[model samples]
Target: MSDAYVALEGGSVVAARCRAPGTSHGELVFTTAYTGYEESLTDPSYEEQVLTFSYPLIGNYGVRSERFESGRVHPRAVVARELTDDVAEWLTEEGVPAVDRLDTRDLVGEIREGGAMKCGVSAGPDASPEDAKAALAECPGMSDYTDIGAQVSVSAQKTYPGDGDADTEVALVDCGAKESIVKSLVERGATVHVLPYDVSPGEVSDLAPDVLFISNGPGDPANFEAAESLVSEFVGEVPLAGICLGQQIIARALGGSTAKMDFGHRGVNQPVRDLRSEKVVMTTQNHGYTVADPGDLEVTQVNVNDDTPEGLESDDLRVLTRQYHPEANPGPNDTLGFFDDVLDMVDCRTPVAAD
Candidate 1:
């Protein structure tokens, strides 16, 4: 026998001699992103959650440093249908360890039937699967993920490379924003100021930025009333743009509402159709909630797959929001023109005094 795969839960040895890690206690959730494993693992949104990959074979292409969204992997633990013994060459170069393989199908089934619970993975002769499952059953579900934004946010304000000697300044509200978004803004020649997620409108007004940007984040957008109020206060004062959580926050600020999705979109293959241009763009996304009352704002783009609202723009308020990521980190580059569009918006709204 293979030492009778042992399972452990809540630090107790429930299974013994398992092929997988002994036990890892956390709220288990599955992702169907297909690829971009490195990005998914490093996403601050998955904090405290054990991730299970629905795609059976993983780590075949291996991990690369260039693909990492952050400095390190942040998942509580990783579960996969089968962990590859041989990772790609880039992963070896980056020194990322091959994921300890597990029966992902069993893990996903258990999470679905049992309704998402805390669990652990361990490696030892004494580890028991039964004990692991029992301990996980006692753990909680994903209820307080809204707090994740505050936890992962940057501690202090910072700036990144922007279009050198730019005419307009853009204030980027960092709700655990990806570095690539900063890079995109910088490349556009727009001076960028990265602030904490809770930055107030008064602070932004004091900066006198030409544009405001809200970055993507994790968790329920409804919990961020302060951010919504701040954006509302800044409406029409400056050209504003947002992605993912930023989009939802802007919608709420504009008298709209947001709701959680049955299974939140989290991948690179999502298709969004631009209403004005009637162009289809394959984009990346990682959000749990979307605007509920898009009519309150001017809807700009819609998802063809499910008819979900994808983008919104309010000409009266000089603000725009997109539910998908245009940064294209670990995804397609079809929608990168959105960055230029933002620059144009800022140009159109430029204060005559600054110009």
Candidate 2:
């Protein structure tokens, strides 16, 4: 077998061979999760960046076809410390390519020292590691990530099956959204209409939904000018809820601010505490940006590790959001009730059976 070239900055190999060609680059970040590699790759929040796995071994358990959050692989690049030849049987079933391996410790050290930089991974002997590293180093950072939601958002409208005869209708804005979030709304007896990320509030208002939902996605929320306005207009006029990128957008609408994290939280076991209930919940998280300073929005939940804002609410507008995934698939179930809370906020009363 021929050797693959990997790009490194400050001695860390941030990109490896076989990543998608002609892809834009950004700072490479690392995630410590031992599992959920599939979910991580498809997450929109990693839109402009490459990802490095801190776990020593990857592709051991392999990829699952049934576990995809989005329609395609969305990461700019994926780097691992070691690659296993004996990929799991599930990977063969799924038909996803095995990730190229590189020196992860070196990559981690580079990101830690340099703070983060754009990088790429590709295959072939002609792929020069030095050239790729230099190209990536010169590329811009997270500022470009602002436009990521528009790039990855659904191009057309869509819908999902819900419980029979549901009274509540929900209009969900897809910002590179995951299917599970739609499933949660459906299970709660809601008729869901999925729209593109750039849809305006007036467009969604035409749907006459009882509640508006902003799904988690990739990129910086500040760049979504229309979305910010739409969300802001809908606040108080109708019930609203959001997660991940959606969360940040809602905060922005409510006069809050978001900032890029030092390293970002990407795992299935991140712990968050509910300031309202004073309960700690382990959650699935995948995002490079977070609410920098929640100016007017009331902070409801906070990360236990770094005290970063995890959840926020504007009671006056009936708007609520979370920086982490409450619909975690391969992660914890502690925050699942948060979805129920969303339904309740929208005043979707449960029907009482005849006595």
Candidate 3:
């Protein structure tokens, strides 16, 4: 164990006393999520990013391999006010850098006001302002990391047997899919064919799936050109749906545009309103970018706090998307029925059988 410290883009050490002897750098972002540290650490969307946990104490429940969202940890580093024995041990074993024993309140406030910034963390006792400055210089900007999504995406196609009763087959294009997303489909009796981020529309069409599912992932949606092309090719050809990064891609495919938020939403308590019913549902979410304008797509749900687009739909195209996680592994399942909508949409397109 060694002393650790965290530095921001300005070369200022925000916190210190890190015990792990590892160094990391990335965009410094905070998540107000109070639980599910394991799931958050493994979420692919956190790739190339340093995560700050706003919760006072972390790792109270210990680690479990089954709780991981991805096969490996995705965050570059983690900052917290206090780290429990179980958590610190798990992070160390995983080779994930972490820092604690300092005032996270000040650090979080700095991020809240200044927004997420590029940052560096080191577990060496000799960490200083110069070390911080040098690390900052080496840190790449978020937009500059265009290959992040592909880096986290599956290398080849994989298939999961759907547990749902329907004969529906779904072609899932994995940008950086979460394990829960796959489970969500398979448990619902839908066979999911997971493909690479750059898989062509022709390849997916050849699968003869009843629906096209775009998965939530890392990086900017604009950087995923092949996925956008696939979406463009299948807009009217198949029933389409996505979540988080998937939502942004669908927006881009429909001529809409996404923008990086000043401070992105990441937590389980975000309230979103279903425009049709004007009803609010607390949801789980994690993303730095959002669909600012849905273009020709109809807006279905909105964030109650910021009025950002939370969900989109198009009856004519049979396309649907949500910015929050419906699978809700670490949060509420209020929108779990959202999957039912996908099934219903497929059912509508299914030709009735004659007796």
Candidate 4:
């Protein structure tokens, strides 16, 4: 007899043991990463979602705060085949629900076929399948969390100095930004000012940053109107860059459109090919939305598997964006050069001559 139950949107309930006791609801999703459990847990992009580990055994390596993408776990609940004492204890301390010792393969298969869907988890000595179902009944879809940015972004602007003698200035709009993204910019001789998602265009104009970078976040892209406004306000005036949700926002601001993916890309091994260079690289990704139309921006890179626009660029507008995380905290370093390409835009930030 198990003390935990996971209720899916289709009225199916799965029994499991309680690794961390609690009750929660979210969009059920999975990641195929075999490592970086700590980073995945703390990732802000996982906000409002129930994270399932497709890997057979999780927490083989102990949890470490240094590896975290954010200060706390963002997933509403966690599902796994097995959980180590270390991870279970960590999730418990964070007050996040967790359940394991179940058939993760079957759950992953369902998500793959049926797409990400509403889910609820009830885990504790007193938990019941009915409790899980009740949570699911009340759970809202991801698009409904319109103000999800407030749940993960920093309230006030925080600045991080670059390595000694930094030469560039970057104003990063934090729509649930990962710490690694900031660290990556700071390490590259760029003073990074992380602003809240709702920062006004005037405020950013006052800063007059060398570049404006939108960050990865959760929820629907249409909901982030402020970030999209920033992109429209600074398109040709300042170098613009974005990742994951950031990319979607950029495309939306540039007369493009975005749409929700079936299951989304949430792993460390997605392959992307640069259309211009004809070079392919394995990348890390975590977003439920993709740019269905690039608008004014040219599609410079695409996913090898699905041909989704992985990279969008506009030389005339001084803009560059990627649908995957180039900082790659818990994934590959193949795309880390993305930061360099961003800085190059700063060097080329001359005003376009009027026709």
Best by lDDT: 4
* lDDT minimum window of 10 residues, candidate 2: 88-97
- Candidate 1's residue-wise lDDT over 1-355, tens digit each? 2322313332332222223333455555677777888787777666666666788876778666787776655555566656564332333333332233446666556655654555654444554456455546655545555566677678678877576777668888877787788888889897888888888766777678888888887667776666777787777778889988899888888888888665566678888988889989898887667788975688889998987889998887788788988888777889888888888887667442321
TM-score, cand. 2 vs. native: 0.87
Error of 1 at 273 (Å): 2.1
How many steric overlaps does candidate 4 have? 0
Query: With candidate 1 superimposed using the best TM-score fit, by how many Å does residue 193's alpha carbon deviate from the native?
Result: 1.2
> For candidate 3, lDDT tens digit of each residue in 1-355?
3367677875477657664557778888888889999999999999989889889898988899999999898888888989988888878888988888877788888888888899888776676656656666789978888777678888888998877466888888898889998888888899989999999766786787788889998877888888888888777767899999999998998889999987699888999999999999999999999998898799999999999999999999889899999999897989999888887788656332222
RMSD, one per candidate, in order: 4.6, 4.7, 2.9, 2.3
- What TM-score would every model get versus the actual structure? 0.82, 0.87, 0.95, 0.98
For residue 206, model 3's alpha carbon misses the true position, in angstroms, by: 1.5
What overall lDDT, based on C-alpha atoms, would model 2 receive against the true structure? 0.72
Q: Per-residue lDDT tens digits of candidate 4, residues 112-185? A: 99999999999999999999999999999998998999999999999999997967889999999999999999
Model 2: per-residue Cα lDDT over 1-355, one tens digit each: 4234445444444344442233334567888788777777666666766677888887677666577777766665556766555332333233332235556786677677676655644444455556566555666666765567677778888877679776787888888788888888899888889999889666786777778888888766787777788887767677888999888888888788888776778888899998888989899988778898786788889999999999888777777789899998767788898888888876732222222
Worst 10 residues of 3 by lDDT: 346-355
Candidate 1: 10-residue stretch with minimal lDDT: 1-10
lDDT of each: 0.70, 0.72, 0.85, 0.93
